[model samples]
Target: MKEITRIIAFYETLKRKADVACALAMVVYVEGSSYRRTGARMLVSEDGFWEGGISGGCLEGDALKKARMAILKSKPELVRYDTTKGDDNQIGVGLGCNGVIDVLFIPVDFENENNPIEILKKSFENNNKPLVVITNSLKEPELLGKLFYFESKQSIDFLKNHLDVGLFSEEILALEKSKNYNIDNELRLFVEILPKPITVYLFGNQYDIYPLIELLKMLYWEVRIVSEPNKIQNRENLTIIAPSDFSENLLNKNSAALLMSHSLEIDKKNLRKLTTSTVKYIGMLGPKTRSERILNELAAEGTKIDSNKIFAPTGLDLGASTPEEIALSIVAELKAVFSGRNGGFLRERELPINERNQEIFKFN
Candidate 1:
């Protein structure tokens, strides 16, 4: 999400100038193992400026040249890089990643409303709605580089003529991540899913909350400080909401709350408000005994706290003492919880780092 945001910001600056030529390089397909999977993108400008990346530094140089060519010709081109061949001269770099990567370079047309950048901007402004982006990758010349955005079941009607709407609808309904749809080896569509960003509500106004907010912003997650508005210093992209103005309805499955006011009364008050909400995670900043006492009091008052959703003394066991270190631990735990992970060392895991299998569909 942060990469996407940076690309959009850079593109917006180019749009304002209205003279620079730029192309978007996106990894459309990946076979075997690659540093980046599908949907990874980098924006290249004619002035030799680039933002984001498509590979682990080795492929960027070659991708930059291809993107420049695409911009010069004002055409969309697909280039494949085979790294399985252990020759440094192949791409001028020893890419022993044992992977095959396919990249698509599309010149940006500022006038076209359906341009790739424009489509991405729309997806970013989708208000946390899940969006499916269909990009033509093969065979059809006219449809090549063409992009379509679908947000709901009704939007599938637009693709009925070109795709198997039944299967596509099922994929969308199931919330599948992203994959390629191959049709008789003639046409290929990269169906990419853009999910909502994780939202965090900080129920505090203390000094420690600053580091946490900064970390969350660096990850480009939506962050809101739920405290007295006057207590928070005005910062860009950080929303400050008064505690009285906070509502549980604003939270969702992708939302988390951190009670870090360091005040027993304030934490208790916030916990009570979240009891009836549908939030999946509630982190309390303090000792286990303090949080347990609050929970006990709430339970005695018939609050019915969900033990599974509460993380007393929020954060992993990182032996963190400083504010920044503690913030890092808490943010790591939040990511693990949201991803359904146990926050363990990757080296200890027997399975692959990315264990979720991507499914591909075929249609004639």
Candidate 2:
């Protein structure tokens, strides 16, 4: 969600500048170690301003140059960066993690109906799910810059006249099984399937809670503020009454919730209300003692809470003291939880940070 938002924001900015053409750089394939993986995108304006990043600073300068050429030629181009040489570097990180990256830069016009970013922005803004976007970088002056988008959940009747019906059918079937991003060079397609962001329910209305709200919004996660009807401002994504208030309405089954009302009584009540819920994650803001006390009260009440899903003294041990830093820690936890990580140091992990797609293809 944040990725799509970044593209939209940069495109809007470029549209405001007079005679400022734009190009989007996206990582199509990664050979070894790269900071960002396939589907990572960066938007570069002819004026040198850019948003997002395809790689650590190592690749942006080179990408900016390619973007300028792309804008001038008004043609999409695939640029390769081979940092496998020990001497080759991009802002120091690439030297440590040498990799080969294929970046495709496509000129963009915001007003154009077929613009890829515009299409993507609409999909995200509308909260459309399972949007599969395919680009054939190898076919310049043809499908190189063009994109094929489909709502994978629906029957693709429009695909009858599609330029690559067989290709679409094969990949769509594959997608139904794995439902992940794929860089199929043999098919000449850089396929990216955008999934829905995880939903979160924040059960608080305190001033400090505002910081958390800000962070979540930046991540483009759908957050529902569950509280008293009069406690919260009528925001677009906020829910005034708690889900427990109405049995028919429940929090997203695959969601995380935070309990931080600043009042012990209210927090305890919330814990009790959500005790039996299938909502996997229940985060309580405060010291371990406070959370334990709440649990003790709930236990005495004969409520059976899923102890494994409860996160007391929520957030990583980041030594966070300020409200903003605390908010960062909390959101970090949520991200780690969503990815099934322990929120620990990345260096400790043996696997790549960007989970590699098991399905592999090589470009000839």
Local distance difference test, each candidate:
0.83, 0.72
Task: Report the lDDT tens digits of candidate 1 across residue range 143-258.
Answer: 66666566765766755666677776777557657777776666677777776789999998889999998899889888989987778876556688887788999998889999
Candidate 1 displacement at residue 123 in angstroms = 1.5
lDDT of 2 by residue, 146-254 (tens): 5545555243444343335555556664663223232333234555656556777887887777788888888888777777657776566654555456331375556
| Model 2 weakest lDDT span, ten residues long | 177-186
lDDT of 2 at 76: 86
TM-score of each: 0.91, 0.78
Candidate 1, residue 196: Cα displacement in angstroms equals 0.8
Candidate 2, residue 303: Cα displacement in angstroms equals 4.4
Cα distance off (Å), candidate 2, residue 59: 1.4
